[model samples]
Target: MTLDAPHAASRPTTSDELRAIALEQFASVGFAGTSLQQIADAAGFSKSSVLYHFASKEALLQDVITPAIDQLEVMLDRFAGASDPAKGRARFVDDFIDFLLRYRLEVHTFINQGQSLRGIPVIDRAGRLIVRLSETLCDETASTEDRLRLGIALGGAAYTLVAGATFFEDEIAPADEIRTALLTVVTELLAPVTVATGPRTDRNQKA
Candidate 1:
């Protein structure tokens, strides 16, 4: 992996270059294991120069995480704007599939190496962005209970699709197919529907 550089050897400066370097290092090496020096070196910059732009490695990860989160919000917001639940549900899976494919390393970092992710404290916001997205969409249509249940069921689809890849790729065979199937199920779960009565549990338990 290379370290981030100030500019690409006379090339114009842009966010893309730095972000590319970060993604490269992150993908080749786990986020927890990757260092600012490596990213800077990869981008052809000094370590301090990289720190000047990003402040720290954690900040760099935030830069990476921000896009996935933003993309998710935009998908949900656009779906809500579309005013079609079916389209919204399909969009949800499509968006999540892209996010999972693009950020395989980061997803692993989040699910497997949260402690090293620096700042924003994982426990507080592991799924906060998606949760907020769910609330926003649900408040519009799904009943409170259905929202809670479906959001969980569908969100599990996204997380499990990614996680199942890492944990079961060999056993699953043609992991991409499994991921697609997972996304399909997730999309179906997201569609507005009548849920049957189910068991209830105490709300006080902190998950």
Candidate 2:
């Protein structure tokens, strides 16, 4: 099951097919701009069919964000379980950027319409989830302030990575370089020994 695109067949994965189309449209047109009819047409389904799969547009967005958040949770869980702080931190930072890179469309779409998206509630819920994941990944080594800083760094990294990918897509030799650049910048700035700044709310979101 590739997350890259929708492959509609006789497969009993109508939900997945709907989600795949939703994701593509969301990336192309954003949460507000995308229409159920457009998605249904692209997916070879009627608007009512898409509605049957997902009750509403909000529900479809929820479904899309859920998997992306789940991916973050699983990766952060791995980061928390790592034995070495250095490697763990690296993995965490890299994984953070990698998640954004892999889901650049969703991340960009969410961030761009956060004000409207926040009205949906699950948008902020997703933020809290990421913060929770960061808290665990930061663990005992980081104070409340440190965790927030780390989270902000990840958010900033996401923005930079997406913009970088967009700006340099044609100029860059390869697509993966955007993520590599983000990992380098994040790893360098995320040193635990560095003097901490004020509270990074992005990292230490309440449990």
Candidate 3:
């Protein structure tokens, strides 16, 4: 899924153009498998021209996923300071789904890149976002068991998004309904527990 080359005397390739082509290549062939030559060919530019804008393949990848990661961080910050927790939660769910869809290939790029970006600031930011989200799913009163469950639920949500993308090539947006269903499940799981009957056991005590 590469774009056609610009006609003769067309403007020189912009950084944005290189990034876009690199993103498509990385998402398609994976970061490890993609090469600068591929990106240059796809964008109809010399390899050195691609290098002119980006220092290396890793730098280009960092640019590719940085926007999505930045958006995630902004969403987390907004939700953290939101005045109405209920509305915030609902809105965050909707926006998060939107982000996942808008950056479907970008998300795939990051996932397929594996640990190549390890220790990078982008990865740190993403990790912090996940932790914040896990804490958001629980509260000060939430038990350790409850927190663990919340983490599992969030992981399940990510897995479902990737799986849905793999299964439905032409219908990425429609697959968000899967997240909506998973959100319902998360709400139920995060709700406060109530003991309905009988004496509480040792397991319950620990929980």
Best by the lDDT measure: 2
For all the candidates, what are their Cα RMSDs to the real structure? Answer: 7.5, 7.3, 6.6
Clashing pairs in 2: 148-200, 148-203, 149-200
Instruction: Let me know the TM-score candidate 1 reaches against the reference structure.
Output: 0.55
Q: Write candidate 3's Cα lDDT for 89-171 as tens digits.
A: 77777687677667766766554444575666665566666667777756566666776666555555454555665767554
For each of the candidates, give the backbone clash count.
14, 3, 0
Query: Over the stretch 7-100, how does candidate 2's per-residue lDDT look in tens digits?
Result: 4444557788888888778866777889999999989999999988889999999888777777866886787788997788777777777778
Model 3, TM vs. native: 0.65
- In model 2, the worst 10-residue window by lDDT is 3-12
Ordered from best to worst lDDT, the candidate numbers read: 2, 3, 1
Query: Which ten-residue region of model 3 has the weakest summed lDDT?
Result: 192-201
Best candidate (score: TM-score): 2
lDDT of the structure predicted as candidate 3: 0.70
lDDT head-to-head 1 vs 2, winner: 2
What clash count does candidate 1 reach? 14
